[model samples]
Target: MKKGNTLFFKTRPRVRSYAAICGSKEKEGVIGNYADITLSDDMYGESTYEKAECKMLSGAISLAVEKGGLTDCDIDAMLSGDLLNQIISASFAARDFEFPFLGLYSACSTMSESMLLSAALVDSGFACNCVAATGSHFASAERQYRYPLELGCTRPPQSQWTVTGAGACVISDAVGKIAITSATLGRVRDWGVTDVNNMGAAMAPAAADTIMRHFKDTGTKPEDYDMIITGDLGALGSRILKDLMWEKSYDISSNHVDCGEIIYKVIEDEFQGGSGAGCSAVVMNSYVFTKMNAGLYKKVLFAATGALLSTVSSGQGESIPCISHAVELESLAAGAQ
Candidate 1:
């Protein structure tokens, strides 16, 4: 059933399995504890950072499928994305497998966007199994969006580090511990913040807008969810989201957490924390999934925020149009109880 911007999945596609792999730096952080694989080197033995990103993405997908006791051939579709010019990481990763591929790009919000569509496809009987995945490489993103690492440009306090990681989840028609119950499609909102360095500020408004719409459409409230997780709003953006929601009479402060703010063990050096397509992906697949399976979290409202800005658009003096897509995941055990 469709309600406003939200789509309810009666079939309840289950997350059959998931996996995450992070770079050397992330390996020293919180995500490293829960990630399935952590590399000793960010390069992963690849000559180019771009190639390393592809390898990470491919490894994540393969591991997820293997964990489910399945193979690439078992999956009907592969939906993936990355923070590259043409989503080359995802597209090239898909080449390693034989499944039908659809490469998506929603900036940092690509994880939830891909998973939302994966649920829809499985719920509609269009596919029995699908892999939703996304990844981002710090080195690759720096070269593409900002100054190359060779230049050693100083980062601003408002700037967030692009995460070097990848995550993948297999959504299947079969029953499982956690199931995707609904999804809220977000609308674009630009507040005329032209500074590309401050992505959290640019995307927070859209996060609030989507969260508000999700509550309204589903006849729910902030307290209904065990956790309200935002993908990559960092510390500054997370505060902005709370303020925006408060103005609308929805207080999410108690239950809310931003993946970007907590992905790193220490936030001082990284400034605003981590921001990338992989930030939320790795967090969801590793930490959040572990908590859910352990019965610590029964219901989760995952809203992955994205800054829809390109180097061309920014250079043209255009504002950053942001978006956030929300996916509702519920533990089947909670329902059974």
Candidate 2:
């Protein structure tokens, strides 16, 4: 049922299985050991970076299904998105599967957005099994959103590197260890940030707004969750979000973690850190899921933030509008559901 902008899943859709596949760069990052598959080459043997992104998405979906002991025939639907125009990466990846396809475009927040829809579908009996996935490639994103990589543009200190990776989760009604309990849809918030290179600032306000709304709708506090994770707010954005929350009398400094900040070991070398459609996707599927299964984090509030800016909008000098969608995930014991 709906409570404010949050949806409470009484039936609690469980994540049956998940997979994380990343390029060599991401494979060497903090989540390196946890990813299900890591490509020795970012190209994945493909001739082009775009095709490589599609292949990564496809690989993540297939790996997730296989981990769940299922096949394409068993999946009722697939929900996916990416940073590419028209979400071509997700669309092209979907062509490799046999199930119904639902393509989404919410910038970096596509992971949580796709998972929220998948959970709702399963919880409401619209589908028995669904796969939620997304991906992004550094080279492809650079070519599309900024200058061509061939130009060797000097990245600003505030910029983040686009992660070359993909993550997928199989959500089903079947009993499982990790369950999606609720979700809070975010609102578009533009604070007049026009610097395309500084996506963290563009997205931070939305993350704070959605997280605060989720707490209000659920009658919970920041301390109620074992962790509160934001998609790709990076180091600077994460700090801004904390300050925003504190101004509202909600302090999340203790439990807050940003996927962008932790993805890399030496984050400053990559500017803030990682930022892309796959940033939160790979982190949640690899690090977060592993922690939940190990009984490390029992309750997590995951809010994936996105900057809804296109090249045309940037070119037009339009401000970047951002959004964040939050999902409440809990770790349940076997047969608890």
User: Which tens-of-lDDT digit does each residue in 1-337 have in candidate 2?
Assistant: 9999999998999999999998898888889999999999988999999999999999999999999999899999999999988889999999998999998999999999999999999999999899999999999998999888879567789999999899999999985689999999989999999999899889999999999999999999999999999999899899899999999999999999999999988877799999999999999999999888776888999999999999999999999999999999998854322
Total backbone collisions, model 2: 0
Give candidate 1's whole-model lDDT.
0.94
C-alpha displacement of 337 in model 2, angstroms?
18
Taken over the whole model, the C-alpha lDDT of each candidate is 0.94, 0.93
TM-scores for every candidate against the unseen true structure: 0.98, 0.98
1-337 per-residue lDDT for model 1 (tens digits): 9999899999999999999999888888888889999999989999999999999999999999999889878999999999998889999999999899998999999999999999999999999999999999999999999997989678899999999999999999995689999999999999999999999999999999999999999999999999999999999999999999999999999999999999998998899999999999999999998788777899999999999999999999999999999999998765332
Candidate 1's TM-score reads 0.98
Alpha-carbon error at 283 in model 2, in Å? 0.3
In angstroms, the error of model 2 at 226 is 0.9
